[model samples]
Target: MIALDIAIKNKYYANSTAVVLKDIQFSVKPGEFVAIIGPSGSGKTTLLNMLSGLEDATAQKLLGNSKSLHDCKEYQLGYVFQQPRLMPWLTVNENIQLVLPTAQERKIKTLLAQVGLADKGDYYPKQLSGGMQRRVAIARAFAVNPELILLDEPFNSLDAPTAAKLRLLLVNLCKSCGSTVVFVTHDLSEAIYLADRIIFMSNSPSSIIHQVNVNLPKPRKESGSTELAWQSQLMAQYPQILSGSVSTD
Candidate 1:
């Protein structure tokens, strides 16, 4: 459903130029969920922005449904940022409804309920916890019934337990809707649990160093037998972490 041939070069710092991304080539099949994990400043967000068509592709081209990014008619993109980015003045239901572009009240209620916010639709952003607000953000994204969703650290603010639960909920929701998801995170365990394939990038001026298929079954567990093996693999792939003691699960 999505294809990218990206080559990004920028001088964010001094006179030295940095090749943030280099001829990065990848494709996402319809209804597939792919996770991108990398060290900080590894251009993961940059890649996501390009894929979402929010940022101008520097030296790359994206084709979806065999059509260029500009020509693809089926392209409906939704984004979930690290922050919930909810409007404080709006109720949770209203927040989600803002994106629906529909007068269907039933649609808003159904979406709020889908994200486990049925009872909280009347509440405002300030009245809810961080996780709840994020849920509202998610409902807003999925409420649009997007063909492609770009999630950039969607669970960054939540506690471990909350984050883990939301991760699974998101996976199931996407699967049921047949939405293609490109999730970006620095969390290895989150990636392993939620992704069909995990792409790892090295440090700054980074490129895809490893792409491992998560052979585990769907609805992954936090304490699974293969968890340790995946952790070991990521640790080995990580450059600065020489200890190889990083645990993912």
Candidate 2:
């Protein structure tokens, strides 16, 4: 289990009076996929940073089981950014090797195959298309075999078709790894499709405004009628969420 109750203070300010995230609270069960969505500048990335131990929080109390965030030495983390962020100098296989330096060559090849890039492993980052580079990044993230994965709108920049394909790949990878995921996305439909629970946030000085349990069955299809119906019902019930007005203190 992962639990967080923290507030992030602006590091640039001397007084530290500015708080970007205001006492945000939530928990993620093991093997659960949670999506965080909010308006622009709502501190979604800041929250992810805090969770990943990249930033410090004031009066924070984050616990992963019996270990606190500061001392959770056993936890393994993986991150996929909006951009692919691959090393241009490395081949597709070598980029993955950068993470799992000792992983077997056969295992690396299998990962490439899983991401639909089996034949492209020998290609350099510049040789691949934008979407393909992102696929390589995804493959590298999973290669770490992290216990928790953080995604910051990895598909936001892709066209609809490409993004949909990556989403499917992500779902399959998560299921196979049983890794707990905290995905931050601006797209409501994507969140609805991927998250086991959606944690909605307020604007800057953000806090948890509400949490919506998806309650959908496993192996969700993006275009299936069930997904469409759920999306319609969710939007109908909380139209403000789609419009970035769900914040209520």
Q: Which stretches of candidate 1 lie over 4 Å from their true place?
A: 1-18, 233-249
State every prediction's TM-score relative to the real structure.
0.86, 0.90
**Candidate 2 segments whose C-alpha is farther than 4 A from its true place:** 1-16, 247-249
Give the per-residue lDDT digits (tens) of candidate 2, residues 1-249.
344333333432235776677767677888889999999888788778778877775457776764676676766778988789999999998899988858679888988999999999899999999999999999988998888889988997789999999999999999899898999998888998899999888777777777889998988888678889998887777778743566332
lDDT of 1: 0.75
Worst 10-residue lDDT window, candidate 1? 240-249
For candidate 2, give the lDDT of residue 191.
90
List the RMSD of every prediction in angstroms: 3.9, 2.7
What is the C-alpha lDDT profile of model 1 across 135-219, one tens digit per residue?
Answer: 8898888887888888999999678899877887797778777788889988877888888887777676666666778888776
Which residue pairs collide in model 1, if any?
none
Per-residue error for 152 in candidate 1, Å, reads 0.4
